[model samples]
Target: MRKNFAVIGLGRFGGSICRTLSDEGFEVLAIDKNEERVNAYAMIASHAAVGDTTDEAVLKSLGIRNFDHVIVAIGDDIQSSILTTLILKELGVNHITVKAQNDYHEKVLVKIGADKVVHPERDMGRRIANNMASSSVLDYLELSDEHSIVEIVANSKISGHTIIDLDIRKKYGLNIVAIKRGMDIIVSPKANEDIRANDVLIVIGTDEDIDRFERKVMQ
Candidate 1:
């Protein structure tokens, strides 16, 4: 079944979610207090409405609780964001994801029953910093506070070595889940497979282990 999604607040964060969900063939209701913002998304979203989500009556009128998932992406207005999330929780929405402005906002949202709280800005900054920290690191994704998945270009030091010869799992406590060379990708590469310079290794491990691997091998 196609999931019904409602995104409150039609700013950059909310607008992106509405557009992406719509692009993915989901039914998205884009809501905002600003008529201009609502009208902007009318053609792009399954439905668009102009209403202040902080108003309980407005939320009920829109049948927001019936949606499978609701994203509260109110920007700048922390009060409205918190109030809307609180109202959604009380109305028994199955899932509620809120965009928090800061750590304090995240804490409050979690306390008020938000199913997930995202700090997009902080997370993006961390990803960018990690990519810049190592020349070989192509991309990074944080799985948790302690663990991450990273794509790193194989350097000359690790090139021509087989997985068993490198003993990466024992030496660095990291696992190479996949290897991408040009357009070809090898998933769960065999121990005898040889690594070539410039091969992109999709590795997963604790952040500490990944950093150590980057410093000792990638450098």
Candidate 2:
């Protein structure tokens, strides 16, 4: 389903989200206090305007609270970001997501009523480190603080075993979303499908569960 989005700030982080959302066919209103930045996104965003999100009057004028979702992607200026979020909450916005620079910023954003607080820089670093740590691990994405979706190389443990034989869900709590075997790709693989060493498993579950499964089944 298509949704309306509003992104505040037009720096690197905010600019990237704006472009991606626009490309994905979302109606985006890109806002920034900087005239140059606003103009830069004008050609891309459904609507672009120079406005101070920290100011309630400006936010009210733009009807920002009515958007399906609002992203507080303001950079560096933590004070403005927090103030803007507070106002958005007061105005009864349904959802608000804020970008935090550090742990402290993340805590403050959560306390100030941001529906979701994200630390993109720290999270990306974790992902890169996880991929480097294991040979079988292709990529890692944090589903939450504890859960993750991992792309892992299939090994010899259950090369021809079906899901029934593996007892995957009940025993391991891991769900295999897809499989990439050599040049072939399988989406929504069935329970009857046989696993083979060298196939990549795109599995989703808690980090601990994935590790356990990798040891008992994929090993």
Candidate 3:
């Protein structure tokens, strides 16, 4: 069954989520206090409403608890964000993901039982920095502060060598989880599998280990 989703506060973050989820065929209910904002997504979402989610009565009236997941992407108003999250928790919403304005806001959301807290701006900055830092690193996904999964483009230096020959696990303490060659993806590539120039290596390891791999093998 397709899971239902409700997004509160139709700002950039919430509006993006609503549009993407709707495009992906998920039933999304977009809510915001701003009438104009609500009207903007009316044709995009499964349903869009103009109402303040901070009020328990408003939430209950909208059947917010019936949705499988709720995303609180309230911007600027930290107090309203917290209040909305608390009401959702009290209403027994199954899964709640919230966008935190800062470290302090993240802590408060976590304490209030938000299932997940995302710092979009901080994360995007890290991703952009990583891509700019290395010509070989095509993309970066932060698994944790200390660990990450990176997609590194294979260069001539690393090409024509098999996984075992490179000794990545022993030398860099990293795992080449997948190799993307053109449109094909090889998952858990065998140790003897040969790597070619331009193959996108999907690797997972500690940040330091990945950096070491980049400096040694990618260069």
Best-to-worst ranking by lDDT: 3, 1, 2
Deviation in angstroms for 130 in model 3? 21
Q: Tell me the spans in candidate 2 whose CA falls farther than 4 Å from its real position.
A: 123-219
Candidate 3 lDDT score at position 146: 78
Candidate 3, residues 24-54, lDDT tens digits: the string is 4578899999999999999999999989998
At residue 85, give the lDDT of candidate 1: 97
What lDDT does the true structure give each of the candidates? 0.86, 0.81, 0.86
Model 2 TM-score, all chains together = 0.60
What TM-score would you give candidate 1 relative to the actual structure? 0.60
* lDDT tens readout by residue for model 2, 108-178: 88988899887767545345434323467888888786798999887777667876688788999988899
Q: What is the lDDT of residue 36 in candidate 1?
A: 99
Q: Which ten residues in a row have the lowest lDDT in candidate 2?
A: 125-134
TM-score of each model, in listed order: 0.60, 0.60, 0.60
